[model samples]
Target: MNILELRKKAVQLRKRTWELIYNHKNGHTGSDLSCTDILVALYYNVLNQTPETVGTLEADTYIQSKGHAVEIWYEVLADKGYIDRDDLEKGYSTFNSPYIGHPTTDVKGMEFHTGSLGHGLGLGVGVALAAKMNSLKKHTYVLMGDGEQAEGSIWEAAMAASNYNLDNLTAIIDHNDLQITGTTDSVMRSNPISNKYEAFGWNVIEVDGNDLAALIHVLTSENNTGKPRLIVANTVKGKGITVAENRADWHHKVPSQEEFEEGIRELDAQMEALNHE
Candidate 1:
């Protein structure tokens, strides 16, 4: 899909996720919204994997380290034919549903069970190393939250990735600047993300996380520097919904009925404007 088409698809993805969250009465709303575009760009444009190709040696691997935001991933996977829409919207967060709050291997497109926050990059490095050892050309991408960066494990994995010169590994930090409690900086400052990654001997790029074109260009680029790449996606928390935008309470908060309706209306208006464009 072209960039414009991808943008429209992203808007639709967010709309669907919001509805699912509302119906299910649980979700990490702000985190989900913040990473929706990143997920869309990866699933629809960058990753060389499909529902059928997933788990195969030839398929690229994706791990959502910040697993609380699995709603966005679930919506993208369903749209890409990984899971059924009915099952996702209905069975999500229910008793014994694989569609839990975090990424689970039972889900068709999910590569790993991640929700432990700081462990995703380590897993990604392991996968990338394994692929390299097996002579497989698969790339491993790990999506992490900025708040998760505080964990020492992330830096350990970063050091290992650079030590191995795993150029095929890319880590995307959803720099939404907000976490469950409050602003990431106020909670635990993790600023100068790009420089920190670069200091770890990784190639670093920063871009607006909501911009489809920029994400596509950097993520799909082949300019590997014999080192792992880190894309710090600067994003707004609760991105598309006005009421929740940059609000920390929306991190794991379920929206009120009125908030849900207003969110849908706002997303619909955005979609309409995109269609006209």
Candidate 2:
């Protein structure tokens, strides 16, 4: 898909995100909205894996380390033919549903059950190292929330990734800067994120996470430096929605019917503007 098409899809994802949360009456709304563009860029335009390749060792792997935002991931997986869209919309977060609050292997595209913060990078390192050990041409990409960066294990994985020189490994931080209680700055101060990763001997690239064109360009860029890659994606929590944008309370707050309708209208306007552009 072209950049314009991806942009439109992102808007749709944002709207769908709201719908899912509104219907289910629970989700990491702000966090999910914040990273929709990153997920869209990776699944639709960047990753070398498809629904078929996703199950094989030869395919690139992705893990949502910040798993509370699994709603958006589920949507992307369904769109990519990895899961049934009807099943997702109906069974998500329901009792006995595979679509729990986090990414799970029971879902067709998920490689691991993630929801416990800070373990994703470590898992990605293991996968990347295994690929190297077997001489496989696979990449491991892990998406993390900036709030989750407060966990010490992420740094440990960073150090290991650099020590092993895992060029096929990539970590994309959804640096929306908002957590459940407050701003990431006020919560844990993981600022200077790029410098922190660079100090750990990884290649760091910062970009506007919501910009699909920019995300696609950066995510698809070639890497020959033999170093692990980190993209600090600065984003707005609850991005593309007027009321929830950058608001901390929307972290897990479900929107009322009016708010949901308003959010959809706002996304529609953005999509229309992008279409014209």
Candidate 3:
């Protein structure tokens, strides 16, 4: 898809996720919105894996470390035909639903069961290293949260990734600056994040996480160059909705009826603007 089409698709996904979360009465709203464009760019443009190629050695791997934001991931998977729309929209968050608040292997296209912070990067390192040892020319991607950077395990994984020269691994951080309780700076201060990764022997690049064109260019154009890469995707929490933007409470707060209606209106306007463009 072109930049405009990807932008439009982002709005659609945002709208769909908002509806699902509101109806189901649960979700990490801010976390989900903050990472929507990142997921869209990966699933719709960068990823080589499909529903058919999932779990194969020849395909790309995507693990969402910030699993609380799985609502957006679920919507993206459905859009890509990896999961049935009916099952996701209707069965999500219900009794015994595989569609819980986090990523689970039972869901098709999910490479790992993730939710525990700081683990995704380590898992990604292992996958990328295995692929290297197997001599497979495939890539692995891990999407993590800024708050998750506080976990000491992330640094441990960073050191290992560098030691093994897992250049095929690309880790993206949703640098939205907020977690469930409040601002990450107030919590653990993961900024200078790029510098940390660079010192750990990983190549680091920072970009506006919400911009599809920028994301596509960086993700596709960058050469691996014999080191793992980290993209600090600086993003706004509760992106695309005025009321929810940057509010930490929205990290898991279900929207009120009024907030839901307003959110739909904003997303619809975004789509309409894209049509004119």
Candidate 4:
């Protein structure tokens, strides 16, 4: 898909995210909105797996470290045909439902069951290492929240990725600048993120997280340095919605009926603007 198309889809994803949360009366709305563009870009434009072939060893892997945003992931997976839409709409976060609050391997397209913040990078590193050892051509992509970077295990995984020279692995940090508590800067600043990753011996790239062209370019870029790559994606907390944008309270708050309508309107405006552009 073209960049413009991906942008439109991202707007749609943002709308769907709000709808899902509003209907279910639950979700990590702000965080989900923050990363929707990246998710859309990856699933629609980058990743090389299908609903039918997601289990194959050669398929590209995507792990969500910030697993609270699994609602968006489920939506994307369903939209991508990795799972049925009926399952996505009906089976969400219920007993015996493959769709849960966090990702699980039980889900057909989920590469890992991730909810714990710091463990995803470690898992991605391990997957990348195993693929390297087997001389497999697959790449592992891991998405993390900026707040989760505070964990010690993340650093440990970073160190290991560098040590192993896992160039086939890419880690994208959703630097929305807000955690559940407060602003990431005020709570625990993770600034100079790119330099820190570079210092840790990984190739670092920073970009607007909501820009589909930039994300696609970075994802497909050559990394001959033989180190893991980290993309620090600067993003707004509640990206497509006016009220939720940069608001910490929306971190996991479900929108009211009025708020949900307003959020969709904002997304529609965004989509229209992008279409004209």
Model 2 TM: 0.98
What is the C-alpha local distance difference test score of candidate 2?
A: 0.92
Per-residue lDDT over 207-268 for candidate 2, one digit per residue giving the tens place of the 0 to 100 score: 99999999999999988889999999999999988899989999888999899898888988
Model 4 has an lDDT value of 0.89
Instruction: Kindly list the per-residue Cα lDDT of model 4 for residues 186-226, writing each as its tens digit.
Output: 89988877888999999998999988889989887778889
**Per-residue lDDT of 178-269 in model 1, one digit per residue for the tens?**
88888888999989778899999999989999899999999989954899999999999999999989899999888889999999999999
lDDT of candidate model 1 versus the reference: 0.92
* Model 3 residue 175 CA deviation in Å: 0.2
**Model 3 per-residue lDDT at 48:** 90
Q: Pick the candidate with the highest lDDT.
A: 3
Provide the clashing-pair count of each candidate structure: 0, 0, 0, 0
RMSD of each: 0.8, 0.9, 0.8, 1.2
Q: Candidate 1, which segments miss by more than 4 Å at Cα?
A: none
Of the candidates numbered 2 and 3, which has the greater lDDT value? 3
* Model 1 residue 269 distance off true place after TM-score fit, in angstroms: 0.6
